[model samples]
Target: MAENRSILVVGLGRFGSAVATTLDSMGQDVLAVDKDPLLVNRWSSSIPTVQADMTDVLAIEQLNAADFDTAVVAIGDSVEASVITAGNLLDAGISDIWAKSVSKEHARILQRIGARHIVNAETDAGNRIGHLVSGNYLDYIELEGEYNVVKIHTPTYLIGYTIGDAKVLERYGITVVGIKSPGHEFEYGSSNLVMHRNDELIIMGKQDQIDRFIKG
Candidate 1:
C-alpha cells in the first residue's frame, strides 16, 4: 500500500473542497481551511476543517502549515488571496506548495510567491478529455514537455509476437515499461515475454511517437 500523506488545504471553493475530500478518501490526513464559515461547517464533519482566513500569516502559522507534507492554495478567484496564502505557506516553511491559477498572470504571481506547482484545472481537464476521445489511450499522464506515459490495449499487430520480435523500440520509438494481464498484477515487460491480445501495455515516450505507435 502507498504511504499516507498529511495535507493542508487552504480555501474551500469547489476545487479546494474536491482536493481535500479526495485526499481524505485516499487515507491522507487532511486539514481544510477557508474564510467562509458555511463552507467550513459543511465540510467539518467529513474532514478536519477550520474557518480561517488564509491570507493572514498569523492564522497560517497557527495552523502549523509546515508540519504537513504538502499544502495547496486553492483560492481560484482572487490573485491577491492566492499569492498571500502561498506566501504564508512559504513563510511557514512548507516546501511543497501547489497553487491554483486562473490565468497566466495568476500563475506567474504564484510562481513569484514560491509556489512549487501551479495547476490550471480547465486546461488539464480539456487535455484529459481530448485524450479520452482520441480512442487510443486508456489513460495518459503528461511527463515533462512533450513526453507522456500512456496505458493502451495491446495493438493487434503485436498480438502473437514476442516482445523482442515486436521491435517496439525500433518500430515505434517507445518503450513498453510494463504489461497488465487479465486477473493478474502488472509485470515488467521483459524482452522474451510474448504479447497477448488481452494485455494492457504501459508505454512511455514522446507524444508524437506514442501517437504514431497507436496509429500503427
Candidate 2:
C-alpha cells in the first residue's frame, strides 16, 4: 500500500497540493499541513489537511516528524522560509526530505542545509514528458556523459535469432540490458534463449549510435 507509508507535505501551494492530492487519491495516508487555513480548505478532503505555521520550528515539531519517514517542502517564493522549514524537518529526525527549488543557487543552499532531494518541479516534469515522447528514449540518467538507456521494440530482423548469431553489440553500438517475454519463466539462461517477436528490449548506448541503429 503506497499511501500507508505516511507522507507529510508542508506547503499547500500548487506543487505541494498536487503531490498530496495525487498520493491521497492513490490510497496513501497523507498529512498536509499549512499555515493558511484557506489553503487547507482548498484541498477539499483529497488529503488529511491541517493548519499550522510550517516556518515555526516548534509548530513543525508538534507534527511529530519522527513518525513520518518522508516530508516534502514545497514552499514557493520564500526561499528563506523554505530552507528553514527543511532544516527543521531534518533536525526533527525525518529520514527523507524533498524540496522544490526556484533556482540553482537555492538548490545548492538546500543541498548544503541537508535536503536529500530537490526537484525543479516545472522544468523536470516537462523535460521528462518530452523525452518520453521523443522517439523511444526516456532521457538518460547517467553522469558519465556518453551513455543512455532506451526502450525499443525488438526489431523484426533480429527476431528468432540467438545471441551468438545476432551479435548486436558487435554489429551495432548498442547492447541489450534486459529482454521481456510475456507468460514465460524469468529464469531462462541467456545462452539457451533466443529473442522472440514483440519482445521488449532495454538497450543502452551512445545517442548518435542508438539513433543510427534505430534507423538502420
Winning model by lDDT:
1
Write the residue-wise lDDT of candidate 1 on 1-216 in tens digits.
123567788888777887777566545677989999999999999988998997887887788777887887888778888888898888888888877899998899888878887888676543442353234568778776778898998887788787789899998889999999899988998898777887889999987788678667
Each model's total of backbone clashes: 0, 2
Best TM-score among the predictions, by candidate number: 1
Write down the worst ten-residue block by lDDT for model 1.
Answer: 126-135
lDDT of 1 at 56: 84
Model 1 clash number: 0
TM-score of each: 0.61, 0.59
lDDT of each: 0.79, 0.71
TM-score of 1: 0.61
Candidate 2 residue-wise lDDT at 215:
57
| TM-score of structure candidate 2 | 0.59
